[model samples]
Target: MERRTISVTGMSCNGCEQNVESALQNIEGVTRVEADRGGDTVEIVTEDDVADDDIEAAIENAGYDVAT
Candidate 1:
């Protein structure tokens, strides 16, 4: 599996974390997604290679910004 950690901004609560997690989990090949509000970060595990833009799009769609 492939793993990536993305620093996210604008997550203030568990609900925001869930939103980010849900967005990433909907993507194809994504096996796991961990969005931590306390840490302001997101970790994604996928079964196959995935594009960074795809992941970033998901984060943007969730109303958050990902630090590059």
Candidate 2:
């Protein structure tokens, strides 16, 4: 499995974390997603190849920004 921790912004509560988690969970090959608004980070586990760009796009679509 591939593990990644992505920094994110604009997540201030549980709902924001859920939104981020839901968005990431839709990606193929993603096995797990954990979003922590308090820490401004989202951790993801994937069973196959997954691009960072795809993850960033998902976060944006969920009305959040991925920290650069």
Candidate 3:
């Protein structure tokens, strides 16, 4: 599994964190997703060939900003 931690912005509550988590989890290769609103970070585990752009786009679609 590939693991990465992405810094997220604009997450103010657990609901926002959930949104981020849900978005990331929807990706095909993604296996796990954990978003922390307090720390503004998201940890993701994927199978193979996970694109950073795809992950970032997912966050953006959920109304959050992701920093590389």
- Model 3 lDDT tens row, 1-68: 89999999999988998899999999999999999988889999998798988999999999988776
Writing each residue's lDDT as its tens digit, candidate 2 over 11-63 gives 99999999999999999999999999989999999876898889999999999
Better of 2 and 3 by lDDT: 2
Give TM-scores for every candidate, taking all chains together and pairing residue i with residue i: 0.94, 0.95, 0.94
Model 1 whole-model lDDT (C-alpha atoms): 0.91
Candidate 1's error at 7, in angstroms? 0.4
Segments of candidate 2 deviating more than 4 angstroms: none
Which regions of candidate 3 are displaced past 4 Å? none
Residue 66 of model 1: what lDDT? 92
Local distance difference test, per candidate? 0.91, 0.94, 0.91
The superposed Cα distance between candidate 2 and the true structure at residue 39, in angstroms, equals 0.5
Clashes of each: 0, 0, 0
Q: Give stretches of model 1 more than 4 Å off.
A: none
lDDT, model 2? 0.94
Q: Candidate 3 — which pairs collide?
A: none
Report the candidate with higher TM-score, 2 versus 3: 2
Query: Which predicted model would earn the best lDDT?
Result: 2
